[model samples]
Target chain A: MAAKNGSEAAEEHTSSAEIRSFFDSAPPLKNSLEITDKLKEFLDKNSLSAGDGRANRIVCVTSGGTTVPLEQRCVRYIDNFASGHRGAASTEYFLKAGYVVIFLYRRGTCQPYCRSLPADPFLECFEFIDESHIKVREPHSEAVKMAISDHQNVVEKGQLLKLPFTTIFEYLQMLQMVATSLRGLGPHAMFYLAAAVSDFYVPWKSMAEHKIQSGSGPLDMSLVQVPKMLAVLRKEWAPFAYCISFKLETDKNILLKKADMALSKYKMHVVVANELSTRNEEVVVVTGDEKVSVCRDKTQVGCDVEDPLIKLLVEKHAIHIVDSCS
Target chain B: MAAKNGSEAAEEHTSSAEIRSFFDSAPPLKNSLEITDKLKEFLDKNSLSAGDGRANRIVCVTSGGTTVPLEQRCVRYIDNFASGHRGAASTEYFLKAGYVVIFLYRRGTCQPYCRSLPADPFLECFEFIDESHIKVREPHSEAVKMAISDHQNVVEKGQLLKLPFTTIFEYLQMLQMVATSLRGLGPHAMFYLAAAVSDFYVPWKSMAEHKIQSGSGPLDMSLVQVPKMLAVLRKEWAPFAYCISFKLETDKNILLKKADMALSKYKMHVVVANELSTRNEEVVVVTGDEKVSVCRDKTQVGCDVEDPLIKLLVEKHAIHIVDSCS
Candidate 1:
């Protein structure tokens, strides 16, 4: 199903239908069925089906940066600036709030509960007693133990499901599958879209087949805008799902304006707007009726802004669930 | 110093002098001197200085991919394909061969002795006994324990010093410092150049001051060539260091030819050539005198090709050291 020709046609633009066709023509991931089955099992086991009389809410949290490959056999890519920290941290908070989370993350990005580990944790956190014996050093033992136990508890109880993706194709495909599968849950389903997705892409049909050679004097290529999937997502895939998207800007002047545009154009329930400089310290949550400013508590050392952000989101989701039922 | 203007004049090309001036015009990293001091102490403590009568070889292993930013405060970047797996695995083998290693790596890539860990090791490798108790899962315990112990042994003995970088500027600056420091050691120094560095970059002077706005309509960019630092390293920085570069290609036809070009152009002692499809299973060591194919033993499940690759490089380095001394 892969595109047969490389740069055979120079398409100038992409439409929603064209994007959908691209995905339909592209080869399905090898583990798609397995992941779908697992998601179904998790939701069923958690009693998240509509009218199941269970209060458990289910959320899919996407984290990290998505890559736009320039070639079919990708040797180079354009990447957004993200470490997956926000998504991972938010997942931990969601689980703590008694929500089952499907963590859809870029491979090799930070994992929930493991954020506080040292930069080189495996090397810096251990002490050698002898050549054959090793133990966690005293300075890091407490932190490592807590991280491990907390992560284990969530996984053992089946509260967290992780799915890893590397390229743009894999990310969008997996997201569609997950969102479509959650349509049955209606208002009980939520999506925290924190991943920094690329805005432009090289179409598979026009991409180079091999690694791009640098000997060429100059590279002159045109990239088409990635078809905005937000409209289809909100209107068709999971209409009743509570969707929260993010807007990150370097300029403070245009941040809220962009956020408002997203909320209106995409029909997102909430748009969290943040400037690059102060993102870790504060954010403004934008909805049609209200704009709520959330900030990290200054008194708490090493506190993350995601803690308060998740609390507000959970409350908002609960209200949506009740309103939909009524 | 930071560049004054962003893309005012479009420079069409880059040369070695331009590249050196770029670094000169760029702001110096805050901790460059601190890192140099630490490296000096590491070498002095290991008795690797000339006339110290020690046979300890020192190698600066560059790992992972360097990012080429489009903006001064980068929100997006062009990245080369690399996981740092080869570099990380090779570091362990170098350590096993009794070489002191300075691991200069990309911030979040794989690390030495940690390659065997699962992608989400903190989640997959632990089991919860109770809410407060956790242990390594039985299946992963032996491997985890050994990895931790072995990493700790080298670190405690000061045989491995790791420095992390994220951008092309930081990487090139750190590399220059490391190479210049090792200049005093002459023939005892070695460089394993495995990092997938970008061949094209937007010079800091020409990069956008803020995040590139999407509304600007089809972004037009001109990227200047990244100066070939290998040539500078051989002629000016550390001429006597035995250097081994890597050539990765998707086409088998150009793989050996590119390897040979790098060997002759940069005057490198050896160049490892591998096709992307079969890199894990096989690689050819290309030197001026001979080309030796090194393949992984298919029968061994856990064995990596880096073991034999590093062994061969180490032997070649030893021969180079002797020939230089005589």
Candidate 2:
């Protein structure tokens, strides 16, 4: 990546300082010790020695949207829009391509392999034939079977690690933890950051202790910028890891520009750009020298864009791996 | 219920005007016609007329939290804290008490009869024995069966009608539709208001069209009070319907006080008061002449506060039905 311009370099420096203070002021994670232990265990089991020809490749795939709490006890929150579809679908392909996956996701968003199942309640997918017997309804049985089998395969092989988060604080902290854990893998480690993180937040110290009262006329609140973490992730946290990010826009015109900016600013290997309306059907993969648009096969009955998107990314990741070795 | 005080009365009047303007300026519901039709069909089938003493009591139990969108296309939203547990559990109890229920709930929140089932993905609760065969995991089999059976019973009998909402706009609009449809059921109708609604919102007309841009320094947004819908529900929509609302507070001292205020100002028949910490263990039911504390049966392995809470409400509803006829 070319060196940052003077203004951009200054911005990066400021952001680094802000990131430090943000973490310092933020409330400690509720189960940081347990999370660290889990990450260590996951990596220990998956990371083969350097001389092993068939060493497992590691990819930390972040999915879903993060929440910014409006109160300390959290009766209210500001949420970003994400269903985790891209991450979940891509995880399946990453597993198919023989990568050990660490799936960090928001608690209630979509899950890998289970996308075909009824969105929760999911009561519609089951039926009681007798007083004591329940079974998947006939129409849903095949889909349920496929989802279970797929999930079970990776789970039994211990190739997938799932960690859930809710608030932006938890999400960023956990991401850093995962990144730090995978740092030793160098270029073999990939970070597929698809989570829609909050742009702004109420600093924990300044957040309201109780629910904001309603009877008080109009409500005015100021939210500080959520300190940029991507730069630090690239430069400090896991410097040698292959990084991929996403840029989603409602406007088609600004989508590519934003993706380009993200690629440059974060020093990401690739930035996937998708317009809000057409995201499911297609996405443009933006790298330093190319912008490749990938689309689902419209003629195929069940094929989705993720199928081809992950394939292309897998190829790019191979080149990154080879270049790093040389 | 007693009359409102002077300031309370003035606030109510102002709120009524605000409600009108709020609805007038709000974006039209995307599926208003379909919602109206569903409500009508539900009420028509369930409402058995005046002379039938065995007429099914119709209670509209609303559950979960409502969101206030930050943008017109909605990249961000302010959310209230509720899992819809109260509503879901209470709906099961209401059904047991022979009430035909109209469950207006937030999408993806808790569901009645689903209290036992594993939460979604729920992939953990299923296993594949072979490539084509899947079954509920052994540990979760009984729960899956019970959930399926109980849900099947309700579906077969058509005793419950569920309508889902996400945004405050959709919630209020659909709620109004349900209330209007239940207007003919007078004394037989009940409204159990458990949804944690937003206290404030950005007016639709002024909301940004695209995702709010970051990096422009602190974000300052002004949100107007979400116009109270309770007063209109009680007075105009379903004039003689028996109403039960909830008051949840973090502070124990203010719990009953806020419940009392809500009861008088909204002229509700009962207000269930719960502290944030102890809500599932106990609650205080505040009425015109009573402040009854109901606690869960700790001695019993599976008993909950909702079991007693709903029983008491059912008896009170029976009294309400008899008194209204006299």
True contacts kept of each: 0.26, 0.47
Instruction: Name the lDDT value of residue A254 in candidate 2.
Output: 84
DockQ, candidate 2, comes to 0.39
lDDT of 2 by residue, A28-131 (tens): 89999999888777777775434222256888999999998888877889996699988999999899898889999999888888777776626877667885
What C-alpha lDDT do the candidate models reach, one value each?
Answer: 0.82, 0.83
**Model 1 residue A216 lDDT?**
28
User: lDDT (0-100) at residue A186 of candidate 1?
Assistant: 88
Instruction: Residues B1-326, candidate 1: write the lDDT tens digits.
Output: 10012343445334567767769756578898889889889988888776322357889999999998877888889897898999999999998888899999998788887887887666676665664445667787777877777776787889999999888888999999999989988888899999998876777776677777655233445565677788888888999898989999999999999999989988898999999999999999999989999999788889999999999988888888888988
TM-score of chain A of each: 0.92, 0.93
- Give the per-residue lDDT digits (tens) of candidate 2, residues B1-326: 00011222234344666888899878899988888777766666665444234357888999999999988888889896699999999999899888888899999899887776655626767777886556677777777776778877886787888899999999999999888878787888899999998888888888888777675366777777787788889999999889999998887877788899999988999999998989999999999999999999999997879999999998898899889989
Q: Residue B307 in candidate 1 has what lDDT? A: 90
For residue A89, model 2's alpha carbon misses the true position, in angstroms, by: 0.4
Local error of candidate 1 at residue B25 (angstroms):
4.4
Per-prediction DockQ scores? 0.29, 0.39
